[model samples]
Target chain A: MTVLVFLDPRHPEGRIADAAAPALLATDLGATRGDGVFESMLAVGGQPRKMGAHLDRLAASAHTLELDSPDRGAWERAVATALSEHLLRAGTGEAVVKLLLTRGAEGSDAPTAWVSVSPVPAGARERSSQGLAVVLLDRGYDSTLAERAPWLLLGAKTLSYAVNMAALRYAKANGADDAIFTSSDGKVLEGPTSTVILAVEEDGVKTLLTPELESGILPGTTQRALFDAAEAAGWALGYGPLEPVHLMEADAVWLVSSIRLLAPVTSIDGTPISSSPALTEELTALLHEAL
Target chain B: MTVLVFLDPRHPEGRIADAAAPALLATDLGATRGDGVFESMLAVGGQPRKMGAHLDRLAASAHTLELDSPDRGAWERAVATALSEHLLRAGTGEAVVKLLLTRGAEGSDAPTAWVSVSPVPAGARERSSQGLAVVLLDRGYDSTLAERAPWLLLGAKTLSYAVNMAALRYAKANGADDAIFTSSDGKVLEGPTSTVILAVEEDGVKTLLTPELESGILPGTTQRALFDAAEAAGWALGYGPLEPVHLMEADAVWLVSSIRLLAPVTSIDGTPISSSPALTEELTALLHEAL
Candidate 1:
């Protein structure tokens, strides 16, 4: 079951809508041209986590697209409404909360904004506990292209994710569970819906490394939280111009996201790699505490 | 006024729906993930033009996305029903007919397919009659990447068009009317929503040219029709690994699409270039005859 709430001027708390019923016009640019922005985060015990960061990213995405966004208060209220509705309907333990904003229907000036809450999928939980395999695919953009071409909207989490979805499908069809995109210049990038993180232990120094933000990947909110927590806990942090070699040589690698907190990657291209269960447990604990 | 017709298994003639009301679920992946394909064509007196080409391309796009497409007959019936409904409501002069197919709501296996017919926007007609200025933008992908990275879905017209829309918005914000995308490797690509066509007349030999399909541009149905008619009229045809210099050197340049038809490019990147009213007229006539 899913609970939905729309941010409306007429309703201060948000207008609850039936998720199973039709609630969007056919001509909405979100459905037609994919002119929109979205963010998804996890909710525990009917309370949303890291919502401020998600809202900030969503606003940045809207700004990149030149889309008008609702005020933060409206979004907060809508999220609250959706979460309460979810708790009432399903007594949520762990729920996935999503915020969506579109350019609205054709010829209309008003934008469409909504919040949705649903139960966490079983696959995500299973993947987080049991390590999975991933394939590296070319993202078709050089690492430096993002700075030169702002119209590409590379860092924005827009609704135009068909290529990302295709890459994931390609990985699964090729005998992998997920994909990690590599730049045309051969720099390591993020996964379809997650951030690529690697742990390097050299000379007794444990460090967490992620691809640099300049590489045109979305800024991962969960990664940020995890990095902050890890740093406070005496773990070093680094950013890169990372390559696949780094993953191959790392002490452990993970694909991290809000819903799937930390999913350890067991192999790449059918070749088994080193994975440390103790490190996974430690990071997961830090991440949960940070959230 | 807009008229909508949905392709339903129980309704062989298609089911008519109110376009102004909510007709799509908010959870539909087309709105959420932009995981879908679409086609738009112009209809004259309730008859859609170049429908066969559009349908073929739609099927190809769905295949690339691994989406299940409704049978061609179902789409045909839906389009006919929409056009007829549009005629009844608006007394058709020229209507824009769109075919949309989405990977249904959330976890549902069924796809959502529909046809919509609406009157042509006045801006499109104005742009076609009075040539518009265009800006050259980088598409962030090299011309050769498409062939190597099929998962990028470069050749498919998917619903994930946020970048395309952003490019157009950027052009307008920069004092241009439209945008023409160029590959990162400096090869001339197509426009955000149209195909680039150029005419060269050297030593009294008239020729038509378009960028090669290998450059990962969407094959223009209007361009194909015009080229066929021009060839029958003894005009030579050529394909290119074209550069912006080629466009500057051509006698005439145009951005053509199904709805806007043949819109001549008056200038590129704020620089006034060569344009021919005579050529535009002649080609428009040929294209109409072919259609």
Candidate 2:
């Protein structure tokens, strides 16, 4: 079951809406043109985790699209309302919370903003505990293109994710569980819905590495939190300029996201790689602590 | 005024819905992930023009996204119902008709499909008659990436058009009325919402040129129809590997779409370009005849 709350001017605490019923106009720009921004986060004990980071990213995405985002207080209240409703309806231990803001119905000036809470999917938990087989697909943009072409909205988490969904579909059809996109210039990038992270151990030191934000990838909030936690735990942190070779040579690799904390990547393009379950457990523990 | 018709299995003629009210579940993947395809066409005298081409493209787009599209007859009936209702309500001289299909509410296998008819926007007509100032923006993909990277969905007209819309917004913010995308490899591509077409006259021979479809651009229905009519009228045609230099050197350039028809580009990247009203008129007439 899912619970929804709309951030409306008429309701200070947000207006509760039925998630199973029709709640959006067919002509909403979010439905028609995908002119919107969204964020997904994990909730534990009826409280959303890393909401500050998610809301910051959502606001950044809206700014990139020149969309008028609601104030932080409104979103916070809506999220609270939705989570409480979900807890009442389903008594959830863990739930997935989503925040959505659209340009609204066609020709309307006001934007549409809503918050939704639902139980975490079984697949996300399974992927995190087991592992994922990932294929490296070309993302069709050079690593350096983001800074030059702002209109591409590379760093923004907008609703225009058909290509990302298609890439995942392509991976599944090609005998893989997920996909990690590589740039046209052959640099390693993020996964279709997660951040690519790899661990390298040298002598007695361990390091966590993720693709550079300048490479036209979304800034991974979970990755940032993990890196901070790992750093505090005496692990080195690095950003890339990484290639496919780096992933192969690393001691462990992970596709990390909010809901799927840290999922180990067992293979790349049908080739088995070194996957350290111990390292995954350690990093996941650190990540959870940070959250 | 607008009229909406939902293509439902229960409704043989399509179910009429109130466009002003909410009619879509917020969890619909089209609104959340933009996982859908759409087509828009102009209707004159209550009949949609070039509907066959639009429907064919819509099917191709859905196929690319692995979506299940409704039968052609269903879509036809919905469009007919929408157009008749629009005519009755507004008594329009011309109306814009849109066909939309979305992966339905999350976890449901069914798809949401609908037809909507509204009066043609005054801006579309104004752009065609008065021409437009267009800025060239980098689309961030290399010219040859489409075929090898099918997951990019370059040739499919999916509803994930936020980047396309952003490009147009970027142009407008920079004092231009529209935007023409150029591939990272320096090849001239189509406009954000229209096909790029240029006319050249050398040694008393008239020729029309557009970028090659292999450049990862959507197949332009209006461009194809216009080209067919121009060829029948003894005008030569060519496809490119076109560069920005070619556009600057052409005798005339225009952006063509179903609604706008033929909107001449008066400038590029803040520099004035050759725009011919006579050629726009001549080509528009041929296009209308074919439609």
Candidate 3:
């Protein structure tokens, strides 16, 4: 079951809508032109995780797309209403909450903002625990393109995710569970929907490394939180224009996102890569504490 | 006013739906992920123009996205039903018909296919007549990237058009009426939503030219029809890896699409270019006759 709430002007707390019914006009630009922004998060016992970070990223995405969205307070109220309704209908164990804001129906200026809370996918947790087999796919753009062409909306998490979806499908088709996109110039970027992280231990000093934000990847909220926690706990950090060889040489590599948290990558292109269970356990504990 | 017809298994002739009401589930991947294919065409006197070409392109787009859609006959029936209903409610004059097929709701294998008929935008004809002030924007991909990376879906007309919409918005915000995209390697590409066309007059021989399909541009149906008509009328034709200089030196330049037919480009980046009213008039007549 799912619960939905729409941010409406008349209802400052939001208007509850039937999830089973048709609720979007066919001509909405979100559906037609994919002119929208979205964020997915996890909730435990009615408490949303990293909501402030998610809301910040969402606002940045909306600003990138120039979409007029409801303020953070409006979103917070809607999210609270949806979560309360969802907890009443379903148990409060764990739920996946999504925030969406579209440019609205064609020729209309009003934006469509909504909150939805639903049960997390059945196998997502298991898959994240088991680790992922990934393939490197060409993203067809160089790393420097994002800075030169802002119209591409490279860093924004817009709803135009067909290429990302296609990459994941292509990976699955090729016997891999997920995809890590690489720039045309052979730089390791990020996964289709997650940020890529590499853990390096040299001379007993541990460092967490991720591709720089200038590489045009979506800034991962969970990754940011984990980095903060790691930094505070005396772990070194590094950002790169890294290559695939770095992943091959790393002690551990992970694909991190909001709902999945951190999914370790066990292999690349059918080749086994080193992964440290001890590090995963320690980082997972650190992430839990950070949250 | 608009008319909608859904391609349904139980209704071979298509099931008509209320266009005013919300007709799409909020969880539909078309709205969420923009995972879908669509084609828009012009209908005059209840007759859809270039339907065969539109259906052909739509099928290709579905193939690229691996979306299982209704067959051509079902789409034809839906289009017919929608146009007939639109004529009854509105008039027998010009209408804009759109065919859409989405990968349905999340977690479902079923596809949602529909036909919608509505009045064309009021200013479309006026804008086509007055021509366009265009700004050239970088597309951030090399021309050869399409062949190297099929996952980019560069040639397919998917619903993930946020970047295209953003490009047009950027152009408008920068005081231009429309945008023409150029490849990262400095090759002339098509417009955001239309195909670019140029006419050259040299040594008393008039030639119509458009960027080569290998440059990763959508093959314009109207441009193809005009090319055939021009050939029949003894005008020469050329395909291009054309540059900006060619557009500037050409006798006439146009942005062609199914609905707009042919729209001339009066200037590029604020500098007036060579534009011939006689060539536009001649080519417009050829296009109309071909249609």
Residue lDDT tens for model 2, B1-291: 789999999998999999998999999999999999999999999999999999999999999999999999999999999988988988967999999999888999999999999999877678566978889999988899998999999999999999999998998899999999999999999998999999999998999999999999999999999999999999999999999999888999999999988889888887888888899889989998899
The C-alpha TM-scores of every prediction are 0.99, 0.99, 0.98
Clashing pairs in 3: none
Q: lDDT by residue for model 1 over A1-291, one digit each (tens)?
A: 989899999999999999999999999999999899999999999989999999999999999999999999999999999998888889957999999999999999999999999999977767656997999999989999999899999999999889988998999899899999999899999999999999999999999999999999999999999999999999999999999999999999999999998999999988888899999999999999998
- Residue pairs in collision within model 1: none
TM-score of chain B of 1: 0.99
TM-score of 2: 0.99
* Model 2 ranges off by over 4 Å: none
lDDT of 1 by residue, B1-291 (tens): 889899999999999999999999999999999999999999999999999999999999999899999999999999988888888899968999999999999999999999999999877667566988999999988999889999999989999999999999999999999999999899999999999999999999999999999999998989999999999999999999999999988999999999888899989998899999999999999999999
How are the candidates ranked when ordered by lDDT, highest leading? 1, 2, 3
**Per-residue lDDT of B107 in model 3:** 73
Model 1 regions lying over 4 Å from their true place: none
Task: Sum up the clashes in candidate 1.
Answer: 0
Candidate 3 fnat reads 0.79
User: Which stretches in model 3 have alpha-carbon errors above 4 Å?
Assistant: none
Query: Reference contacts recovered by each candidate, as fractions?
Result: 0.93, 0.94, 0.79
Candidates in order: C-alpha RMSD to true structure: 0.9, 0.9, 1.1
Report model 3's TM-score to 2 decimal places. 0.98
